[model samples]
Target: MADPIPETADTALVPTLLGDVIPRVESAYVLGLPSPQILDLVLERSRSTTVLVATDEEASQLKDELPDAVELVTAGIAAFAQDRRSQPRELVLALGGLDGLLPPADTMPWQQRLAHVTALAQAGGTVIVGLGNDAPLMALGHAERIDWARADDDPTRPTSAAALAQALAAAGQPVTTVHGLYGDPVNPGAAVIDALATGSRDGSLPAQVVEHVIDQAGTASIPAPDVVAVAARSGQLSNLATQWVAVSGGRGRSVYWTVDDAVVWADQDGPGLDWVIGGDADTAAALPQRVPDTITVERTLLRHIARADLPAFRAVARQLGDWVRSSADAAESSEIRLDEVRVAGATLARGISLRHAPVTDAAPVAEDAPDVEREPDPSARQVSASEARLAQAWRRFATRFAHSGRRSAWPAIFGEEDLVQLWLTMSGVAPGTVAPEADAPAVAVPAVVDEASRLDILQDRVAALTDTLAARDEQLLIREARIRTLRQQALGAARNRDRAVKLAQDLRRSRTYRLANQMRRASLVAQPKTLVRGVARKLDGKVRALRRTR
Candidate 1:
């Protein structure tokens, strides 16, 4: 195990990126071992009082160390995020033992958890982490790294301070002057507090450090690949790419891909790549080839910059300028003639000025070379009849109007079909309407011919009428004969009816008929009397039987 720093307030306060960033820190993520000194300084300096500890061990330790007024919770950052009992408060988290806390391969989950912690800290919270040496630096996101080296002296602090200063300067936040942290017997745990106190003692320690680093970084010519790697490690790749796009005169648009074992960079959604560099070689060898040597420094240098990528931009820009000069000299020594150039398959040439004659008569064109005809894009192609009509109308309207602007305005005046018909009418052409036929013309004829034709027609009509009259007369005669038969049948039926009535009257007046009616009436009256007498006799018999029984 490594020896710990001696228990003394006298710690050599080294000027570092984190130290420079500490005073301006409304929030922070100090990635190193849990420092009681640092925690005490943060709690004293920061406005937030709530300290959330991820592990039970940290929580137990904090409960004993922190003041009773400061609330300490053992809940993970995610749990605090879900709790809505009150408004979110700025938090102080003690994250330690990263190597044992999370497995190395579990990057995605680790990133997600870290992002959750970041979200929790969004409300003015600060996270102090104890990062292992093998910790994936990229997964930490854009947080200031504070190295917790036990050794009283560390060189990396100056280097980091320089980088931070240069980055900030490149982003247009220049430092005029700064103070260096090189005092013996300085408090490393209370680094921020010491910085502020030191600055107060000599007008501003951060300012002095920023100026010193900026001066160092501005003059130094570091390798471009080293700068890129540093930015990537610092989680500023996206910012770097954005700056690159902006520098290339692209509207913050770029795509990354591999071509011929080299990274091909191009405009967003463009037809082809603009710059190619990077293959099996490392970043240093590949970076110089990103742009052609002919491109000017002004054209390739980024104008728009993000604060996070400021350090990276400064490092890369300074190095690229030096590389460009060195590479240009090398390229001059081994220049190839146009005739010696080998164009790849499907290579496109545009406005290329040929310094020499045709390169060996343009080697025989391949028979398989496709005669490509571009199909119009769906969005660009005219697909609708309405659009076609609108286009046609626009052309016609342009022909008529003095101002071209009237074409768009004319549509509001007339509906579609109406507009077309109006144009047709205005052109002195009939608008697709069928006119009624005019009355026939009156013409005179020769009397003799007219008379002969009329007489022939009249004769034919008379003959047809005569035939029709004869047929009608025949039908009338048949009807008359039927009517005569029907009248005779009616008369015969009436005679039979009169005879039948007379016979019936004679029968009613006859004596036999009268006697039969009187006899029927007498039988009906006697039957009822007989029924009553039988019923009385039966009742009297029943009465005599009942008296005998008694």
Candidate 2:
């Protein structure tokens, strides 16, 4: 076993993540090598006493961190269960699961080890077991192939969440609920109870929320969102989760998921389920006091897309457009996202309000100004704040929509930019009114690539490249025309200079020129001052010519 490590910020939040499932009790016993932070949370939440059972290595590090008031037992599962001093407790937390508590020397079966742990909990008491799924979708392409010939591997261990639940039931503690833990198994960022996970209908609001939770927990190796969508529709998402937190004789919240750094959980005690945020004051304050009901505009649209129902999609699109136009504040309308807008019967209202830092506009530059090299400013635009915000929101939605892989009313040939223009028009915003700057940075969507979406993305890329090439071609044509005009002007000036030189030569050669020269000499002779000035000018010109020769 590795040395016990100190609790991290994420691990510290594990207690909060599992807080609903872990019941408050008078006395609690935590078995195995759980995180020190979890132990601390248990200690703090327990009313009277808390006991920790860990190996010698883990205990060495934990002893310094834990107080003397808590009893620390150092023994294997076999020895600990055989001890007569061991008594039933109100809460038994085996968060490390059976593998962590089992010693290599001990030959106890997995089922028996589970039974021993449950026996420590009193009747009607709560037992929370954290078990890793045998196979998770996130581990699909990354994990190494297992060798069937390995003799040391435990054969009797529970292979799936269902098997583990059954094992717990057989151990005299029937599971009350099984929460699907997402993200890291040690400290899951989100959890959904079995009731919600199994009961939510595919393409419904609750199902979409669960799908989003899995998407957040997914890694780069797997296209979690797309896989989760398909799996949720097929009713297999519960089995594909990374870890399962099974609870016996205790009730927990229906759902819990993290947004940004804050945790949001759905309260089941209320007449209708309502979400409450728990985190830092600032984060909590920024989020809505209550989350919208399950049926959201985004979910309804997605359902329509899945069925290829163009009329239904158009109806919802029209409603969204109408809502955007009717909003008293255009700035507020810009912040409203399809997912955040809830749908109840025929009524629609904005639900969650995500706090985005206000974007300050820079001083707009004149269009006819001379070209100069400078850094591009995103906020330097002629568009109003409302138009800019609307454009930005529309662009974001377009990018996400293209990558979503759902069937849209538009043709397959339509790219991301085309969809943006279409959607903008549909939302009562003119396509040409708010022109996106050519140099504006593209909005980045989640890196979830699947075969279904690959074609759409490639098509969009090709269309974008085509448009870019066309613009560049037009620019090149304008530059060529300008260059041609300059060349003609230079030629005309050269011809004019040649004609003036010839005329001067012809005039100097004519008899009239000699007469004019003599007249000029006569005039100079008549005025002495003029003659002196003329002589001086001639001398200066001669001197300048001499210097040039030198």
Candidate 3:
């Protein structure tokens, strides 16, 4: 670890060391036909040597029941990768199954292939994986066999080694012409070249080869991902790794490839967490250790920036006069309201707002982004008569992009509008807008109407109880009145028996007295409290009866 202290400041020139990088091509596959068919086609088209690595189990099977005209090498992928150091390869094209070069099948998860690549990815080697169609291979996780729909969804999404080889070139990787590193492109190649055509300063493709050569680089053509900012806020880019660099840029913006030089800078970092790399000429050698006080990248300070991290890019413009601190432009999207902040689905209004928004800077967050909720664009607002109509039916537009659950569906029905109030209410987003007028949707909330809510059942029970209580009271009162009348008539009649002169009058009067007496008795007996007490007394009187019934 030596600083660049000008080795020699001669009359006019000073010498400097240029970095080195190696080219690597990785192909993602779909597992089945893509492995057996498309892979070979690409190899043949690219004019590279294709070797098949096979394990004992697969070799036994393939040797007996070979398919078509598939030519394969029978070593395990690990063994072959190790042997590359001994025999070496200019371009190692490894195919599938018995065709793989690695041997000893007890290891290697097929997908990661971690064991072999570790040793084989040196300056002398360039690795290329051939996948015919890995759809079935990847699909094996969900089902016993392959799923056609899911497998074929995107035929070319997997790594294409041919494309990768081109990407490495575009990335300014270390190796030169296929022959320069592997020594001779294909036949009778030497393990190392003791010959001519020195490579780039970094020992990549020879200056002659990469000087202006821009062919076959696919990822190189795409637009580079920009540094999107969220002010003080941040999130993890789940789509990529922790140490991410813009994969495509310059002539091959779309093309993504890794250079050995990039890895060197990343590994040399002395725990420079979230520090950015590559800022002006100063960042070239900025290792992390020197800036123990602040989170920093080597000289550049660009390497430390997190994918989702957003510290005000040039908040104070910490520079000397004419110098600007950051080169990244701010991401222009509007911010989520401080009140609407949500974390793990708890309405974090008062309790967690302080956590999300530290007082230092006002930055937006990118983690757990759902589609954005729309607010009136502050620029457009004038009170009008439509206020009434709008209140009655304010239609806030919502598309699939407005929520987190459905990022994939954004392409279809984009920019569509639905009632903002209804959508917010349905999804339970904070600060839900309500219907404009008092009468609007005043019946019941949608959640109440849902059959699963059990409102209907509760309402039925309430109605049944009301009817039973009302009817029972009425019936008991009538019974008491009838019994009283009968009792009064009997009493009057009995008294009149002594005198036959006014038979009907005495009978009537006696009946009235009997009825009144009966009515009083009936009232006492019919009382629910008295009936319950009598039942309890009877039970007490006949304990044996209760035991027998039991």
Candidate 4:
């Protein structure tokens, strides 16, 4: 089809850097589905104790149709983290076929399933692998033994993902335009699949750019591909998120992740429900609600001037200059005019003066970086001269061009354990041992038998089997029964383990609370009222003396 856009990680990691700006994605939904275990874990671990599971028709349909249970569980987690803004907990995805009835995978290949799961975990859900897997089948593109797996597309689902878009638009928040398949080659299928959409030849993302991005993501196996690289709207980059995830990998080049809207614009630290509505250092007196606490705008004043009238620009620039506390620049301040344009989310106005300086691109973390477990001086990485200049130009054209920063931060997401675990799950021996072009083995021909010879052979076999048939059938029944009993025992043990884990969590919480109470009681004492009374009398005497001296 359309040369199935390139599905490489590089293609996915191409962050839209317009004037040193990036995009963010926002999602809101009920999370943790179809499992009391997951709900319990989330409740036990998260800041919010109230856990919700959407027992709707859609979840059921998704479970039945989805090939991977891990995907479904991950989907639940992503929905909670993004839309629900719920604290994350581990959701174990029971291995495919190991469970009673594996979900039917009607379409989409195994590769897509694996990547989507990676995306979910990256978005902030804890995914874990469940037991009972076909290890050999995993080698042949079958997935089992998945851990910390979640799908990205479910959060950015096709029909249900318009809330963030509309909210942002209404609040005048920047938006990153994205499309399906062609949008992110490396992450072909994403959660925020708003629709089965298409891009135009004259769109912002040209066909060439799409090809470049896709190639960066990874190559798709298509025969006789005719690829055209030109400035045609290949598609918008929606559903920003981490493209590459692994439970295990030999130290190698960084992998890419598709961008998600909620994550794309997450604040430098991350999104949190508690954001100060006004009086924040973002330089905006009052930002619209669509802007989450975790996100930061490069220059709201520059963006406003670029999008509005010149007269309006004067007022906005005046306030911005005041906020920057630049007492040195405004004395010789002058208005700006646009010469050229760069567009991603906002239409920026450009001019050469003290008003705008080149924005800085955040320096890259050392390749094979591990995690952001600690806080640091929100440092922007060392950058190049050309990149700084480009960022300035993008800022000038703030209206048409918007930058989504989501793609810039994939590596920090979907930690090492999840990635290695998933890779282990989806990898092994290739599909079948029988080669595609292999021929059947030859067999020796049986000696020909006449009708009488056949009759004699059948009669002899029947006479011999008459006595043994019952015994043979009984033996077969016994074997079947024994195997069933063994299987039942194994399953029972697993269930028991699960129950034990649940009990352990409950006990842990209770003991923790109890210990905290004991410590507080022992470490603290009530103030003595008699001592307080003496201190008050002494204070009164001292005050009376001071008054008399005055």
- Candidate 4 — which residues are off by over 4 angstroms? 1-3, 6-237, 240-312, 323-550
Q: lDDT of all predictions, in order shown?
A: 0.34, 0.65, 0.29, 0.30
For each of the candidates, give the backbone clash count. Answer: 9, 0, 78, 97
Better of 2 and 3 by lDDT: 2
Question: On residues 15-96, what C-alpha lDDT tens digit does candidate 1 reach at each position?
Answer: 2212322343343332212456556655555554565555677667666777775566555445554562244334323333
Could you give candidate 2's per-residue lDDT for residues 1-550 as a string of tens digits? Answer: 2212111224534566557666678888888766656776787778655554546787787778777788777887766777823578888888766766756566677777788888888889989887766555555565451222111356667656677788899889999888777665545656777556655554444455555655554553656556666666676767665667788977766666565656655555442455554454665565555654456676677778777676787677666666555644333443666656766455555555333353343435678877768786665556555555545655666667777765665555455766666666665666466654554433233355566677876786688689889999999999999999999999999999999999999999999999999998898889999999988999999999999998
Judge candidate 4 against the unseen true structure and give its global Cα lDDT, from 0 to 1. 0.30
Off by over 4 Å in 2: 1-13, 21-24, 47-54, 143-156, 202-220, 268-281, 295-299, 302-308, 327-334, 351-390, 404-409, 436-550
Greater lDDT among 2 and 4 belongs to: 2
Give the deviation of candidate 2 from the true structure as CA RMSD. Answer: 29.8
Say which candidate scores most in lDDT.
2
Per-model TM-score versus the true fold? 0.22, 0.66, 0.23, 0.20
**TM-score: the better of candidates 2 and 4:** 2
lDDT of 2 at 464: 65
Poorest 10 consecutive residues by lDDT, candidate 3: 10-19
Cα RMSD of predicted structure 4: 38.6
